[model samples]
Target: MLNIPLWKRVVIVGLVALGLLFAMPNAFYSRVEGHNDAVAAIEGGAESPELTAMEGAWPGWLPSSLVNLGLDLRGGAHLLAEVHLEDVYASRIDALWPEVRDALRDQRATVGTIRQQNSAPGELRVRISNPEGIAAAVQAVQALAQPIVSLTGVGERDLAVRSEGADVVVTLSEAEQLATDQRTMQQTLEIIRRRVDEVGTREPTIQRQGNDRVLIQVPGIGSAEELKALIGTTAQLTFHPVVSQTRDGSQDPGGRNVIYPDLEDPELFYILERTPVVTGEELTDAQPSFDQNGLPAVNFRFNVSGARKFGDYTAENIGSPFAIVLDGEVISAPVIRDHIPGGSGIISGNFTVEESTQLAVLLRAGALPAELTFLEERTIGPELGQDSIDAGKIACIVAFAGVLVFMALSYGWFGILANIALILNVGMIFGLLSMIGATLTLPGIAGIVLTIGMAVDANVLIFERIREELKSAKGPARAIELGYERAQSAIVDANITTFLTAVILFVMGSGPVRGFAVTLGLGILTSVFTAIFVTRLMVVIWMERRRPKTIEV
Candidate 1:
């Protein structure tokens, strides 16, 4: 211990200094946050006097990373939503209709004329005029079934077709329904994440709950309703051939026709074909722009397949009207003046610039395959978070004061060295948290306070061992060296077990439990380093300078 190397001492001092430097920004958290935001905005081509002032709030040379605060610490919106997975079943059945119809139409001589009949939810029935051709019609529809590629459904086909008298019945296989639910859940999660990220909310917590629910906690959003508005719209955009314009809902729309109202005028409605010529899924890009009339609009481009279909439809149906529908409301219906061969078009609507921008964002993020019914929603205020911070600060201060006084009273100058190391350990924790962009929460603060009490364990063990060696009439340097060597195993054994517990908690827990685990795990690493290297290095330096005949412990 007395013979510490020159390189080791330099490295120890350098690390401590670096940690304190990284942690300094937290002292002026708001200023550093402003500086970071200003810098990001300026880089993004935004310029203003306010931005310039914020840029100068903190020095550019200093480290600007700050520990992000979790929702419980910063306040935000929380929601628990149950996904309506059954909603996709009906749409899936409707989607299979075109393929089934085309297959049956190809064998028109045998099947005669086939017409879709009203059936139960998630089932499609087709009636063939020639009852003797029921077997042929079922075989034709069954040919459209595709193999499912999932692990649990590897050998199963997605559809099952059967004939009852002159009617051919079609429904999704059980395995296919299971696969669809899984896909819907995954797509919903991904789309919601993208939408939230586009808005740039800090440290949002979005996770699956049970099998059919999602839990969302977004910090910095005003309320749960605001967040719902941002992600709730399905954005299911489609282009359909308009059958007729009418305001009568009670009138029959006829076979395969649906009535939808205009987005701008609720009373004005358009009857349209149930199946769309093209859907938003085929879109590759969408951006907000002004149309030829200098009105707010969204310009969208489609993939190759969509482009071909759109071009063919427009070319064949020139002079007919096609409606652009979004989430069941007709946004616009313009007559095709010419063939739109490039698969790109502008959608003009009754919208403000902000609405157009949001629509573009949603289009780019894709649509939610199923609906979300909110089970719970809450808005946590900043004042409540401020109270949590204040309480945590008081608890930490009290813990630090008690630890500092106890150590100093027990070991004199060596105690003071331990206290300094303890302070640096805390700084290093925050430094590491900032480096990784960790979000600190209330439970995480408790972990830090608990760490403060645990950090002195190794020091106490080493100091007591030194006292024992001193009483045995050993030299000061020899006693210090033997104390650290003897207590090393005990310290290692104790911390290792605690570290394992932290690892297990991190893996098995969620939300607040995870926050606590992260802090505890990081604290263990920093505490062990400060205890073994930092305090030991300080003692060695002091001993080498003083070279005292006697030492007090």
Candidate 2:
């Protein structure tokens, strides 16, 4: 009665062989990882004899994918950063100044010369010489308000314009503020990812935490401080028109201009327009290079739109000084000697080679929307991760040995079949992890250990059911069939519930908890297949060959 079709037999054997073959690379993890990296570099257009030889060391047809170790299992840096969303609000209001001034100017007969007033960061306030026209000024500014294009901001306006005493105040509506915050966070996450990726670190975890936070984990990084230094720079690069050069700090430059001291010469100051001619977001490329004087500098190219704007500005204001501001400080002020037609230009300053390179990287990665406040930072040492791996390996071996010995003493040869299936189950788990490129953590190791016990528990249940059926009038073959049939419902129900729990954990938890859920969920699947199908096939084959008349439980 126990028989397997030829196709079914082939399928079972093929799966086991394929799993082992794919999982083989993990045995030589470092070598395989090196091979993979070398291959990637070649694919990325890097040509080197050493990399070619390294790629040749591994077989071309074989799968080179390996399970990535998580921050807990590999030395890394972990950072929790809170984005300063309010910073965007101030900039948003500052940006609206030009439009507001234009709109008020068009209605000059009603609202006389308009002047901006000092207000809160997110609030925009304006005063007109003709206080009687305050109502008209408010109406003019309100014309600029548009409907917020967000699901939660349905039917709500983007800006809230109001008349306060003799001044008109404008602020972002609640719905608009929410939408802006979301966009700011998304932009911040993207820029951070780009910056981290530029360094070519492997398998870095960059994820949004809450509404205004981001969590970053990078493996093999030296410390949290190093990671922070790499990504923490605001890198707000802006180009503004220089009004005048001055030594006096107390003198008022104008309403829309600002006076910033030179980085190299503190006594020297440049009064520059607040609004930028172009921002770093329009940069297409930035590279560290030398200036005409052989000084360290960064050369940048702009996108089509940025180039046109910059080209026009330089053409109209020949010989006028243009200030390059970095994070609110004037880095360089260079006078436009000619109408530069091309989008490419150089930024020269008192910079070392390293500073120039760093600046270039930042410019290429784009500027962050808002500054990030470090809420938490931690460095995980490689030594500690190694110790965890060592302990986990010991625990796994101990659990595996105990299960094998117990199953062998209790069920004899049938237990031997289950043990074989258990070994294959573990292999398949690794194989799946490799194929999917899942990250392995210390918690994942614990999940694997727990799976060893569960794998045998199914066999124990089936074997006990056989022992009970043997007491009836049925023979060995009939009793075995009945035992498996009776155990099916119980095994399926138990594993299904546990699998669902694992899914829930994965969805609700973060970091290590999710890692544990991954292994636990995959273990359930592999163990179920091994216990129900693979073990049954092995038992059927053995029985067909031996054809035992009577069998002991």
Candidate 3:
């Protein structure tokens, strides 16, 4: 056993205590409203009473803030969405086959015609006019197939392909084809989470489900409809010149007339057709700001390429009004007086602060790859979270008490030392969690409970080994030393295997499951340290001080 200095032990314990002290306010007593109010008061050129109180009441410890509570423990909605791979495949097939037909026509390879037939769930059959260039056509199709997960021959000439699960498939599409698949879905979910977080929603859980699915749980979010609207639509934005038709089919009396294409019904328009000069993708940054006219608007800056494009488009199209379209709706039409060279422009519409902010957020998140469909949604209430916390606390208390009683009854005085180490182990877990700002889910609480039970397994092994050594006529101190030494291998082997499984789970799992795995893994590490090192240290000190002739086991 490596002998740790007493001063080193003091420092470790002192640091743990200090961490707990600093974390208390953020963990249990810090009020969100109070923090906000303090900031607002200070901003308004007034002294904040709350700030003064906070300063006075501040605990003197390193700020190890409380673990972030997860949605499951804090009551939040759980959502599961399956990606419409079928729709994506169909769209890809439709788009690609047309290009294929055009290429074939250009090559003059087709002696007859081309047709598409459905083979399997995600398989496509392309009938060609001539069998002469069929190999070349298949090779051409294979080039496009590179972006897809895997392409295999269904029969003789038919091709069968499907995305490889979720992550791999999404990454392949996003990186290779610029096709939005699983990656798009996952990014959309993350953006939505950021948006909700900006709105001060606490402990929201957003994660990717299977391959094409997303699971989101927003705790304490009352505005489900608004959130759905925010998350479900593709907020594609574009700037187009207003095309006007006069009474003579040339020009209208109005300066410039603009039309918007209806998203649902392409045949209809909110306005007449206008060619787009620029799209939102070129935007580098957007923020809510007041325009020169003192109207709430979204001020945006474009990249160099976008600036050049916008400058060229506007310089040529002077006196023509350009309509800013968002999600297929005309938001504003501003006449170009001078060319915008720097790529900075203001979207001045009649907007409230909230509307302007939301618009800015939408612009920042960029356009969604495809239209989104919300298949499932749920909202968890704070009361549910409170209930979970209550239940978890009860379980933890029961487990801890049960472990304590079992240890004391089984091993007498030495068991008491193990129980003390167990208490420290719990403290160390919380301390580490607070220090790292880990989010605690219901599964995390269960992990702690399980740790409590498993922690004793180490001590139990050591105690059993000591009993065996005593039976072999070993002296008290010698038996104690041999017991810990012999049991070390078994204890390490068991914990290491469990730790490996936890690592795997943490890597592969999502959201709450990952939280559970993280806690379990961390607990195992801390338990090993406290159970073996701490317990051994205590036993050594006790033995040196008391020099007991026999140890009760």
In model 3, state the lDDT of residue 21.
Answer: 61
- Residues 286-403, candidate 2, lDDT per residue (tens digit)? 9999999999999999999999989999999998889999887889898899998798898899999998998899899999999999999999999988998899899999999999
lDDT of 1 by residue, 417-534 (tens): 9999999999999998888899999999999999999999999999999999999999999999999999989999999999999999989988899899999999999999999999
TM-score of each: 0.95, 0.95, 0.75
lDDT, candidate 2, equals: 0.90
Model 3 misplaced regions, further than 4 Å: 1-57, 81-183, 186-190, 200-203, 245-275
Summarize candidate 3's per-residue lDDT along 60-106 as a digit string, tens digits: 34352556778766665566655555544443444354445564455
Residue 452 lDDT in candidate 2: 90
Better of 2 and 3 by lDDT: 2
User: Model 1: clashing residue pairs?
Assistant: none
Q: Which of the two, 1 or 2, has more lDDT?
A: 1
lDDT of 1 at 444: 98
Query: TM-score of model 2 relative to the true fold?
Result: 0.95
